[model samples]
Target: MKKKNKKLEVRKPNQEVRLASNVYIILIISFYSMIGIMTLCSLMLLIGIIAFKTNNLPLFSQIKTVISTIMIIIVLMFLILYPIKNTIEPETKLEKDAFIFALNRLGLKSKCELEKLNGIIHNLKRDRLHFSSESDLYRIYLLLENGQMVDYLISLRDLKQLIKIGQKVKIRNSNLKLPISGWCSDHLSISVIDEEGKTFYKFESYEPFNNKTKLKGRKIVG
Candidate 1:
């Protein structure tokens, strides 16, 4: 009886662990299911509203109430998921090395020298969608060699920065055109001109590259 009781007690913890894992799995499934349902409902409701207005259907007030409720639920979901959204995963050492090699091959050797800045890239997030032209949308978090963390927002195109340099060179009044193809390179060199059209600072950083495959598959490294 004693041995049997001990065996049962041992099994109890295993059962509890299994139960907890099952509950967590269920929670994840339910959360995603709710998101899908909510999204579908919202899309359907939007279509209904358009149809009602287009065909002059009645019961518009009822539709408005349903739309408003869905909007609130979506807002609440966004708030709940906001913490994890846009969170970037860090690259492994091997991947980072491969990325540095790629950048070096692209002739951005100076910028790849993170040690000079006493910083190591902790995480990097690239813009999957071409959303903004004015802002540095791509984000890179750096862990300083001194143990401090900082982030750098780098631009996709050098057009704006190059134009600013042009302004300083008294070329602001002159219509200057740069090849659209040359405007964006993720790892390329840029030569800035001074007031006398002399080459000023020429270095490399995350600018823009026209390689769609390279840009889209940035996260995958061998």
Candidate 2:
């Protein structure tokens, strides 16, 4: 009986250990999958750029068509794969505390008080549906405290008629520390929450304002 009890205790921890390992593995895989897709898109973009610069007209023409097709596929995939409804998973107090701690360590200010402000969507433009653009698409000037203005680049698709100016929207997952330079800046994922609390994922542009708003929306910007 003593030996059996000891074996049961060991088995309990082993099960827990396996469960924890699986969670980490899933998170890692999700992170890497996102990165990989973005990287592949970047490579296609680089090839197009090199061909353009070298005056390889035939190569550029061929690649442009292929890249465009791949981008369409990616968009369709995202729409099909992602859940349609806004669902927030409930977190335990301990899990919530740990998440806050991790955010603090990442140099994010106001980690606990991060609130998404509703802004009127204006100056909307759709470039490549899947990638970044030279100019920030879905532009909005977020009203901030102390009369300061925070200009943001909203990056997402299907915005042609879905959003407009004068429409108040609530936003979530606002990150303040990331630089606004390229297409794949390390900004936090932001979701637009409507008045009814429906959350929709959208990309924000984090680059400085250049007067030109309309440009070819591609992966790389010069």
Candidate 3:
């Protein structure tokens, strides 16, 4: 009897539910920023009133200068601290629940269908020599509507099973034309047609995108 081959399992990447935590974080930052602005304005008004009433006395002048300096420092601190706060705060259960609710509202299932795209693979390149990481080893290049070609990154492990260069393909739930779009990398299914018939190849961890895709551009639907 012949021995059977075992399939390899790719570990799912740990991606944050950014929309959930971002909403709370933005609200917190905005609230504190507004408060700081109001307080600074009040201090400035007090200084102005004192200067006007006292006819800009020597002592009042010095006090006003010190207060102005303090106000500038506070504004600088606000700029620095808010960004740190955004990163340090952990996502709570409420945020996670809200994210789930949002997904449900949008009618998107986990690794489910969203849209279908059709395009020809303009080019494909594999640069194993210069890249420092395995993920950067392979890329499927596609020509955009504006006559510019963009390289979409893919894992080197899935390079063999993916669509070939110059092949006309109908891709589901992926938009290569957009600068950034949602791609379900974990569950990839590609169909190839030839003179013989149609053949389907299902793969795991095969999308041509990384986590930075979400941060660089707009992909609100995913």
Best by lDDT: 3
Model 3, range 172-192, lDDT digits (tens) per residue?
Answer: 333122101122232233333
lDDT (Cα, tens digit) per residue for candidate 1, span 1-222: 001111111122344444443433344345556678768877886677566654554567666766776688689778754443212111222222333333333333222111123333465466546555444455445565457765444443433333231122101011111111111122333333455655444333332333221211111112
Q: State residue 188's C-alpha deviation in candidate 2, in Å.
A: 3.1
Off by over 4 Å in 2: 1-116, 122-136, 144-148, 173-189, 195-197, 204-222
Residue pairs in candidate 3 whose N, alpha carbon or C atoms collide under 3 angstroms = 115-173
Per-model clash counts, in order, read 6, 7, 1
TM per model? 0.26, 0.27, 0.39
lDDT of 2 by residue, 44-91 (tens): 865765556447467767677667756875775465334321111112
lDDT winner between candidates 1 and 2: 2
lDDT-based ranking: 3, 2, 1
lDDT of candidate model 2 versus the reference? 0.39
Consecutive 10-residue window with the lowest summed lDDT within model 2: 1-10
